[model samples]
Target: MLKLFSLSSSLSILFLASAHAESQVQLSHVPSQSQVEDFNEPRGASKGVEARPILVIASELIKYFEGWYPSAYDDPAAYCTIGYGHLIALQACASIDLGEFARPLSKGAGAALLEKDTRTARIAVQRYVKVDLSDEQFSALASFTFNVGKEKFADSTLLELVNDGDFDAAANQFGRWIKAKGKVLPGLKDRRACEAALFRGNLQSGKNSTFDRSDCAGLGVASGAGPVIDIFVGE
Candidate 1:
């Protein structure tokens, strides 16, 4: 069940500074069927690498894998995350001031945050990727960059091979990122595999049967203070 907490009056002082900076989208209703249909339609890749955006299906993939907490929760890496895995701070949710945050957020509000986060991921891919890509390939890389963080993605052998236009080798690099909090998490392995498959145009899942793995089941642990994800690493 979705957990909710009433905002205590004492938190007003804490809320003053951040309330203006946080997501203000109050979703009162779900997207219409037509809206979903439009989003699902292929936005098509740009001729240049700098302008490409992930397809709608790619964003949905990120959303499905990320934790759905209308109320903030401590993520594996110890970040205070809320609304489809959007990380904020390490502080308790109550101590963080989110203006108008009514505790449990609606699915629509959560999705809005996801959409916003994906844009940053998309920009990272566009900025570093030099080769032209199919919609699926760009989407796959965008998802990878989103989870792994832009700094790591930028320095990754995966990015090196991708910019070199050696896609097959790049596809294998996803498996290398299967550890989090300095331990191997089983969940990260499958996530990497699916992402690899998606880059190879063979991705399929229960939440989605669409166009994708590097199954890193036997991968060794890597050291990290954060989640298997590195989004906060260089930020």
Candidate 2:
């Protein structure tokens, strides 16, 4: 493992070298926390059919919030995590041996693993969502699933509202997940707000995108689109 002292200096060089490491180009898959400006979507009601999922701007959003961690560490849930919030092991830190991650994880590997981890969310959104969604909306949901576990999302009222074709109510549910382990986290709050904005078809860019909100109210009054972030597969 690279020493912590040299990590920052060595990181960029390492990433440049490892840029060639990810040969098999791939793209891919959360929960929680909330911001963004509200906007009105031009589309009407959602079509009651499954659509293959694709991502737009979710990766950059995720990376911006999740930051980068090139080493294994325990998350708030005690899971052995690595890369960009990838759960290498779901068990508690004391229960699992992290000897395998003794070496410093590379940014390239982390990016690949991020794509790999996001696959689960993409599959979940594809399988469970019963309504047709725009790319921005789907990306928002995908981002949500990536943060929260699949089971939680599957059983969530948000999913229920989406299936019921109640988008406004569904949008409101994004704020319900801002708490981690019962405490309201600022990071989570900002993420949900941004996601809600995207879900409402408002693509927010630059420094002013994040807002400190707790719910999805008033997110239905605006217009715009977001940028594409990563490789995604859809039908």
Best by TM-score: 1
Residue-level lDDT of model 1, residues 88-151, one tens digit each, is: 5544555777655547888898888777656656777888899898887899888887776666
Q: Global lDDT for candidate 2?
A: 0.59
lDDT of 2 by residue, 100-172 (tens): 6757799888877676556656667777899988888788888887776555678777788888998877776
Residue 57 Cα positional deviation in candidate 2, in Å, after optimal superposition: 1.4
Candidate 2 residues lying further than 4 Å off, grouped into runs, are: 1-53, 91-100, 205-235
**Model 1 clash pairs?**
180-228, 193-213, 193-214, 197-212, 197-213, 198-212, 202-212, 203-212
Top model number, lDDT? 1
Model 2 weakest 10-residue run by lDDT: 31-40
Worst 10-residue stretch by lDDT in candidate 1?
Answer: 25-34
